[model samples]
Target: MLINPTIEQHDEKRRDKMSQVSLTKGYWFFFEHEGNDISMFGSVWNGKENVSFNNEIVSSFRNLNKFKSEHSFSKNGHNYKVCTHMTNMLRGTLVVSLYCDDELLQTETLSQIGKDKPSKRFFSKTFLWFLVFGFAVGMLAGYFNLFG
Candidate 1:
């Protein structure tokens, strides 16, 4: 899936960094079937360790040439065939465009935030504290002034 750059950039960075240490280097494996046979073997290169096929998003990029010769899928009406499992794998195409305030999430999730600073961080810690206290006291005074 194409992740939102503003949100998923960190994840992408992590994946790219960890992919370099493949002891054997990131390489491709090929296989073929009857009309369109296919095979793919690679560990999911997340930020951490190389995850297994179950976790990786295998696609044509893993090996495009071998891919076109293996798997077969019907498109429009034609039964176009592919040679590798990667050929049939789902691909993630990230399309980043300008988003307006209306397009953003209404809820506040931790992933959407940068650092864990509170809402009041922009203001001085001491002044903000006094403002809160003053607001509380003023409310109480107004209540007593009205009821009493």
Candidate 2:
């Protein structure tokens, strides 16, 4: 099975930091069945390095073949909804939706990676070069205005 999962940050402050660092803030796991991705819904960090999965989800995956339903779980004040739908009798897909308080944060589609993949790093080399060029241009403009 091929699994592709995406994450969306909710908090403004944390989002800003993630944009600058591109580091994984939490851990996630999913099960693949016949090339279909079945993502677990209720795993969260307990302020430690290890992630904690809800007991219900664990049991459901144990009997995954018989599991055909939707589940909801809450962690760190965030609510999540997860479900799987069969495209055919033999293959299906899973969807995980996340919300903060009452506002929708992000919805991840777990599937195979695409050709236009995003850079893992937050800041690219080209972005750094652009920053340097902008700084140089600003300094030159200020000098011309003040001393020319």
Write down the lDDT of every candidate, Cα atoms only: 0.29, 0.36
Which of the numbered candidates is closest to the native, going by highest TM-score? 2
What TM-scores do the predictions have?
A: 0.17, 0.26
User: For residues 71-94, what per-residue lDDT tens digits would candidate 2 score against the true structure?
Assistant: 555644555444433223212222
TM-score of structure candidate 2: 0.26
Best prediction by lDDT: 2
Off by over 4 Å in 2: 1-68, 88-92, 111-148
Candidate 1 lDDT, 61-99, residue by residue in tens: 333333222223342334433232232222211111111
Span of ten consecutive residues with least summed lDDT in model 1? 104-113
The lDDT, on a scale of 0 to 1, for candidate 2 is: 0.36
Count steric clashes of candidate 1. Answer: 11
Separately for all candidates shown, the number of backbone clashes (residues 3 or more apart, or on different chains) is 11, 3
